[model samples]
Target chain A: MIILNQSKLNPSNIQPSEITSREVFENRRHFLKAAGFGLAAGSALLLSRQSQAAIAPVTFKANSRQKISGFSKTAYGAGEKLTQYEDVTTYNNYYEFGTGKSDPAIQATLFKPRPWTISIEGQVKKAKTISIEDLLKLAPLEERIYRMRCVEAWSMVIPWVGLPLASLVKWAEPTGNAKYVEFISESDPQSMPGVRSPILDWPYTEGLRMDEATNPLTLLAVGLYGEYLPNQNGAPVRLVTPWKYGFKGGKAIVKIRFVDKMPLTTWYKAGPSEYGFYANVNPNVDHPRWTQSSEKPIGAGLFGGRIKTKMFNGYSEQVAHMYTGMDLNRNF
Target chain B: MKKQHIVFVKAAIWLFALLPLSRLIWLGVNDNLGANPIEFIEHSTGTWALVFLLITLSMTPIRLLTGQVWQIQLRRVLGLFMFFYACLHIITYVWLDFVFMWDELLIDVAKHPRILVGFAAFLLAIPLAATSNSYMIKRLKTNWKKLHQTVYLIAILAVVHFWMLVKKDLTEPIYYAVMLIVLLGIRVYFKYQPHLKSKVTKAM
Candidate 1:
């Protein structure tokens, strides 16, 4: 065990420049106490302009209405490297644009995500359709560092900017009967090529239990890495339930419905056996096709070592009570 | 065919087969291998394995139709390349993916049907690759022909492995499946049409 720890400490295994740089090294030391050394280095590396440019998100003409705010940051998944913006955008699982990881970035380049409208309806006391500008003005946006784990056994630490879904839910004034919230992404096949194929049922749908939707941790993210959200990263606005797998956070959302019962989700509807409705990040509950026991951190590059996946993506303390008295294995 | 042409074709096949590997090396060295490099390597090697298998599978039909007996001899080299890539794909998983965790790897293999099928395909290819040499071919004689036929099954298993791994958007895997079906279909059609085969052989 001592030898193993010593070997891991050796910087040769990782990039020499990262270990040798004074700023990165100092940041690692200061942040390592709070966050894992790897996660600290990963976040610090993301701030470097070179990596930022390399993983550049989709560029939209900056909208004046989108106000950017910096907050006292708290690290989630400390020691985990933030997935490069390039990979996060380019290596997307946005089936609406296409299936290939790189497809959405390319296909979504021409997609107009601005001037969007989202309708708040269903069991809510107030039903209103609002423009993207109106939605942006609804609340103050703050950055939350989250560990976004994909169902495919790959994970990333993303610094997301958005307001809590709870704030939006309260504004909508959900009725007492409201038990679930369903979100629908833009479904134009004329622009989104992947929607042309039956790979998934079109008009991608995702839902959250009302409590899960309104949890303090549930975010309706509008930006990432201090910039407006990239189109492929679900521009304008999208849900970010950090404890669940990334898919549960529906992208390019156009509709928000508060319902009395569970809603049909795209992946769950397509392959019920492979994708569960909850889609919580449970390491013990393996997908039918792959194991969830471990995940390859994005931006760790090809040769980087794997890390054991944490329960609820290491957010169990904040969200575990929600699943009390329930069996994840059966529900999963 | 002229000796020059045979040498040129051999060299071209070698170059074409090594292109994917060379590109991978370049990407790895340059740090251009995106977010999940292991996945990039695994997918690249796995794609090349299918490519080589498809090329090797196409060779028999090409030889039967064109009567290019020289191309028939190249099948062994192509088959070996396929086996080499399959080995790389498995190595990437065992070494890089699971990092020699025998227990985890074992459990994964048992649980994931795609991994099991992929492993079976690799295992089946080993004997055929091992016996690709002239000595084994000469020693085994008719048995060699029977054993070598396992390539068809291996190819099918390989495609199935890809098909299962992809959740939806079967476009990529379906392409391989169609190509393999057509290649296999040609053989079955030619076998039943012995008279037409003789005419084609005469023309060649």
Candidate 2:
């Protein structure tokens, strides 16, 4: 393990005001480059320990290889800055790679999401398997900045570019009997090591009520921040339900099934008492283990503080009419 | 035990104990604490606390198995480090996470069973950490042993606290729980070994 000598970390050299300045930090980056420790750029941002190996900074480029049209940047809700692409891609909770937040960022680099075929079956008029490329051809994509609130009470404002789920369901021509839409994620145990362990039932599944699926706010995201989805952030395709907790949005999905009954989601199946079916982002309804009243936005620093969590993640104005008569606390 | 050997062991323990804090400081200063730094700090400190507690608990069994009386000397260092990390964990949650809003914190403590259990575990660890010195052990005599027995309960509580905090994946907590159980099982086996041996002799 290469240890950067502590003597070289001169606090006086790095101006106190410039310590948090990203621009000034770039200067320090250049300085480290000149000093020949450029290789430790990522580790340099983190303090190096003698016992452990230095972690290489994860580097990924936004490859918007697919042409998406009719998608204008329509800003939505509270106008929080889109989380830094680096942070958004690196900081993930996709347990398919592993349970650790950073595990997906590192381990998912090798996952091949291309040549991916999704089987769209169940209660749809045209139940057939389709290639991801063919699905992309279904509708014009739109860039929607949606607030993704995790069940863990942290959140991110993500700039997602995708077609509306309503368009996909329209193409599938869902049967009148369809009450729910179930999503099954890709589960190759050889690639997705998390599948080797029963952290969750293998071939992760998540569901949305048919109306929720047809909601305009519900997006079948193909990219983020003008780039194709990073493997860690669910490459090729994923669901983005802006009004619900993040887990409701399954990643690396392989199957989209329109069903007659409320589908059993992976989390709700594992612990029904903890994770409810309609995992809506209701500040009034606290999770069994944690309060949902507030959320710390991702990329918020140590002193950068938390904000009051908005009901339905601030999309209540648009989607509140759907659950008019149901008790949110019970359904949550 | 040789004086020089004991000194070297003490130095090693101290250095090892300080590694997690040094790593945290490095991560904080470098601004490499990912998106949720408070959660990162809380988790890192909390994990280290359980790790140190497991290490400390293992010392008695190690001593019993190896017949190394000197193994007891390292227990204090590990126990103190466990308390130190637990303090950091609580401080981060209360100060940084909640900003010391005692009312909100209290309400949460009441509402969340995991938080309440974790708080109880931390509170129970206080007397054991406070009485971890040779002078206190000498003065308290048998009371010290009785008081320190709370460490086992604290270990169980810490594991449960972790198990409850996790959303779905119980793999990590399950691993910690198994480690704690094995460590305690070693002690129980040793405690009853002589009785089992005598019973075998009578049967023969």
Candidate 3:
């Protein structure tokens, strides 16, 4: 519920009184000190609050994020506690800007997400480019809180504001031959520094099967936290397949191609053995580098231990039928 | 170097080595550890461990190049500091990251080669750190030198652990690998120099 304006909370605004005493600030040192005095009770709550206050200044900058209006709330993730707006905006994995988690927030200041156009190509009724302004008007926007899980074993619960991707798919009127949908993100070397490096293929790409693309749970998010999507959070629009890993959400999309053949996604091409095409959040199938059985929830204080990862990231009731017979272990 | 000068230099190295830990505390107090504080701490401690390990490896080469015995004298403290940071890095992973979830931790170590390699490197460093003091060094004598030579393997495993963890962009890991290669390469070249010299003299 806290609305933080990143620009307003400059580091210079820090007052000496706001900071906890040094002995109490360092949790381990404080714990030792408290244990020495036999007053170890109630320290955990105090430390968690202090840590929360530490990152309290990290929300979207007022000048950058425009308030989105007239979106209806949905029953999605109704009972879940929403991740702090500051954490959602500040912690990101937009590689176009940079690879580091905090890189996107700092490096995406110059990225212009407005006046954007998405070129719909291949197997559609007619290939056409639509402006972001036109795309925003296609359907009634709804705010859906969804749990977004990253393949790196971290997750955040975000209230995304946008229409279901199925609306766009229906509007596009794909031909019978269209069996897959591919999303290609913008990659301007001038604006996106990470594009210059050969980390993954330029113009980051992701795709979903025809059925998955049309699923109700799949969203085309234009904004989050009741504001226009921050430039770092893909800006104008991006895909949100809650059942899959966060990488499946292609940001700053410039192209959407409906193709007969399965498209090779960026992560899949980068490391075929590790990243798979489906990328469904399955706890049993572990990533080659790390375990997928558990994920650390972001905004959970330093002491907040990891939670057990769920099948389909806990959206199996809606999405499990799509992959009923598919061997996820081999596909993963 | 005078005995007092050596003592002063050791104190300075210890202070410099503690700076990374001090920096982490400063950042923690300021709430400047970024969005993922645990990750920041893990990376900081892990990177410092590798840096100290590389510095420890460089001592023999420095002595070889500059013929300075003082460089060798600094190696133990530098090596111990590497072990110290390595301990903190592993503790962060086990205590903070997993919170003593032994089942998950065991499965991760078993399933992921990256975690296993890093764990192995820490295990090897244990004895080296244990026998670093004067009493153990005198008691073990020649065997101590043989046992400590495993540092070469530990260094290699540490670099490989880093190399495997990165998804793409091997630039950082490659830099560490190159440093390890150069440091270890110096020893190999020097070890064979006498043999090579004899062969050249016979041919002449």
Itemize residue pairs with steric clashes in candidate 2. Answer: A47-B26
- Predicted candidate 3 versus true structure: per-residue lDDT over A1-332, tens digit per residue: 11111111322223223544544556665565758644544555555645533433334456877888889999999999989887888788887876666657756777889789999999999999989988888999999999999999999999999998898888888999999999999999998878998888988999999999999999999999999998889988999999999999999989999999999999999889989999999999999889999999987877888999999999999999998888889987
What is candidate 3's lDDT per residue for B1-204, written digit by digit as tens?
Answer: 888999999999989999889977887888776667787788778888999999999988776655566667899999999999999999999998999999999999988999999999999999999999999999999999999999999999999998897777676678789889999998888777986545534543
lDDT of 1 by residue, A261-280 (tens): 89999999998998989999
Give a tens-digit lDDT track for model 1, residues B145-199: 9999998999999999999998787756777898999999999999999997887
Better of 1 and 3 by DockQ: 3
**Which 10 consecutive residues of model 3 chain A have the lowest summed lDDT?**
A1-10
- Whichever of 1 and 2 has more DockQ, that candidate is 2
Interface RMSD of each candidate, angstroms, one decimal:
12.5, 6.8, 9.1
Rate residue A198 of model 1 by lDDT.
83
Instruction: Give me the candidate number with maximum lDDT.
Output: 3
Question: Which order, best to worst by TM-score?
Answer: 3, 1, 2
Query: Pick by TM-score: which candidate is best?
Result: 3
What residue pairs are clashing in model 1?
A38-A79, A39-A79, A39-A80, A55-A86, A302-B37, A302-B38
Ten residues in sequence with the least summed lDDT for candidate 3 chain B: B195-204
